[model samples]
Target: MSIWWSLHLRREAASVPLARRLLLGTMETAGVDPDISYDLSVALSEACANAVEHGGDTPDGTPQAYRVTAYLDGEKCHIEVTDSGPGFTAPHRAPRPASSDAEGGRGLCLISELADHVQIGNKPGRGGAVVSFDKILKWRKDAPLMAV
Candidate 1:
């Protein structure tokens, strides 16, 4: 079986936890292993937080909303978070390690570390950052929706 969801959320601090909880609930209902669920939830939170903090305003000065999309297919899970910010300066390169004294700038690096594969880039023409990642799925012993 395959499951997928997409969310359009405002760029607000509270939205981060909301997105995390939704992902957790989906994982739990699908009977994914708890460890893997936790890791994905954390990565999702980081990505949402970045969007809330850095998703820029529109040309008319309105705050831009962001999007979160997730898919569970066969034995893999993929998630993507997109924002209307200025986008990464160097979309092709991996994010550099955050300085020890920095309070931020570590989210992308952390996402890459947690997922089996990650892609950080910009949405063509639209001009926004896109952070997408994929992870090998691990089902619980009693998974109801386990891959065939």
Candidate 2:
């Protein structure tokens, strides 16, 4: 069986917690192994943060929203983070942590290393790009995830 979860939230920092909660719930309900759940949570958080930061316009206290989608098959999980402002070129390589003792740009690197597959592309009929990743559930003996 395949399971899906989705959420749309305004482009505010406060919405991050909601996203995290939703992500955690989805992973838990989908039976993701506990050992890898932390990494998935972190990676998904990073992806959503990027979408909220770079992919959307200024907060302005207006009403713009970002979308996150997660789907799980028997042995794999896939996720997509999207914003409403605009789409840009995919990062050839994930941004590296800065040497100035700054904490930034490490999210993509972590996501890339943790997920079995990562893809960035324009969302169909949308104004922004979708940053997506997938992880294979190693603890299960189910068949492979088919691209249906």
- Best candidate, lDDT-wise? 1
In model 1, which regions exceed 4 Å deviation? none
lDDT to native, each model: 0.91, 0.73
**Lowest lDDT block of 10, candidate 1:** 88-97
In model 1, state the lDDT of residue 15: 91
Count of clashing pairs, candidate 1 = 0
Candidate 2 deviant stretches above 4 angstroms:
58-63, 89-100, 124-126, 139-148
lDDT of 2 at 76: 78
For residue 121, model 2's alpha carbon misses the true position, in angstroms, by: 3.2
Count of backbone clashes for each model?
Answer: 0, 0
lDDT of 2 by residue, 1-148 (tens): 7878788878778887788888776666555666666777888888888777776565575646889888877667788888876776654555455566766767777788888888866766756877899988643223233323
TM-score, one value per model: 0.95, 0.77
lDDT of 1 by residue, 33-122 (tens): 999999999999988998888898978988799999999876989999999998877736776789999999899899988899999888
Query: Backbone clash tally for model 2?
Result: 0
Q: Model 1 Cα displacement at 77 (Å)?
A: 0.6
